[model samples]
Target: MYSWHTQDYLNLAANIQKRNFGALLLHGAANSGRSELTNELIQFALCQSPQDLHACGQCSSCILWREDNHPDIVLLAADNSEERKTLQIKVEQVREVIDFASKSRHLSACKIIHLPDAEQLNISSANALLKVLEEPAPDCIFILQANNINKLLATIKSRCFKYQLTYPAWDDALKLVVENNPDNAEFWLRYFNGEPLFTPPFENHELTQLKATLLKPGIDAIFALSKDLDPKRVGMASLLDFMLKWLSDLFLVKHGNNANYFVSDTSAMQGLAAKINNDKLFALQEDLVFLSRWSEHPLNHKLQFENILFKYQQIYV
Candidate 1:
């Protein structure tokens, strides 16, 4: 389990045991404890002796879980690694879950399948998963996690017990960040908006450079970014997200408010914001919104980045 969990998880876990729900969907923003809480539920389900709705840490099932040797549980998520970044849940992987479910449990009384980012399942794979959920195994449970559930198919959403998680308060989030990573804790915390589970899309130095260069956006600078713009190496979505946040902060700075995304670059933000008229900024925002609509699709990533660079260059023109 994570360092923080609300009583909501506890109540839900209790209800899981009480009702024996076949499927549960945990939806939340990035860096919330959705994955950790899901693991806790897995352990609680598999534990031969659960105490107070939590897994008995010393139990054999808990030991297997700690060792990451729980055969009965499978995690299906986009690896987002350098070699193989993907949002699509391949049909073959979904088949594995179905195959795994058809068999008997190995060590525990429970079997679980966890799908992180259920919205990433493409049409075929989603249909494949839907079939499994429609006729799940007697001893199995399915846990679906998504940061944005609206992208999920209605059929998939309808099959599960959905719960949306909330972020911790600033004091609690800061405490967690500092306790876990003291050095550069404040910087990273603010960068991720205090999501402990968040993995930075780029290194600190790279992000800083990106911010500086975008503020002085020129053709050469835009092309310099485009040269290394493969989504696998550095995500287009993350870049767009950064741009959106930066624009938001710029808008705030224009109105005599402090910058949020560029938390350290108040003067730079003010200067940049001053250069652009509201009409130009609004036009950029419209383009970004259009790009975001197709950002997750395979075809539009490069096109979106191109549009963003063009728009960024125009902002200062």
Candidate 2:
């Protein structure tokens, strides 16, 4: 489905056939279709039809893939699902992968291991895996996916075939949105980090109300929530994520990059945007890593966020 837009990546994959590249790195922001592209490659490697642009979905291998039982294709992420969980890719997961690598494929011609979010691996775990990447088995292919390539080690980076996945143009992403879920603009825009191929549920009346409340004075919203003392930790965390995404959009618009803004008019956020620069905007984005990790605990949420807002105010001035 997403293959039509990934011509360049497919061409690169074809080139690899002529001259085999042991490892390929797929790096991109969230929802930029990096995983989809990896899936395409896996399909091509195991596909019964050997066409440049198309994978025959009718083949036995393709049928197996659709059922999530492709023997040669291994996806070793922290979780099998796409949702980001608050845990590292433990040594046990790597051990399973190692075990899989030890054996040959059940049916396919080549063995392929796709590790999405490889950066989630801890130090010892990553190092142990590095040896496999360094001297991979002759018939094996390793594709590493990372959202923040900078988080990976230089040595690890050097050992792979790499490409950065660029965001599609605004018009292109908008077209994707219309084709899928045309009604839920806000949630999709925020969830995929401005990638339009994403479909996040926005029909939830609670999210709509939460968004409206956030648009009020920032400190006022905080104080009002404090009064209610709602213990819906999940909802509160989602609110924080939504607000941060809005702020990120504002920062982009302030720098004359409104082309990327999913919010129709970012003019109302001018005051907030003018208070920060590119460097500060990047720092604020990094701060979100902490927010995402600590927001589940109510005490940590209040205490940490108070300090975060305080520092943000200081930085704004």
What C-alpha RMSD separates each model from the true structure?
4.2, 5.0
Model 1 scores a C-alpha lDDT of 0.78
Candidate 1 deviation (Cα RMSD) = 4.2
Candidate 2 lDDT by residue in tens digits, 1-317: 25334765666568556546778887874575767777777777777775665567888888998899988877777763544445568788787877888897777667888887878877877877888888888778888888888988877889988877767775677677778777765446655656876545334554554454434436766555444434354344654565577666767867867624346546655556676656765676678666677665555555555555544544455
Give candidate 1's error at residue 143 in angstroms.
Answer: 1.1
Specify the highest-TM-score model's number. 1
Pairs that collide in candidate 1 are none
> Model 2, stretches more than 4 Å misplaced?
79-85, 183-193, 199-237, 245-290, 296-317
Give lDDT tens digits, candidate 1, residues 1-317: 55456576787779767755899998875586777787778788888888888789898889989999888899876556634334577889899889999999988877989887787798999999999899888788998888888988999999998888767777777787777676567766786877765666776667656776687787777676666555546876787778888888888998899987577787877777777778888888887777666665666566567667787767764
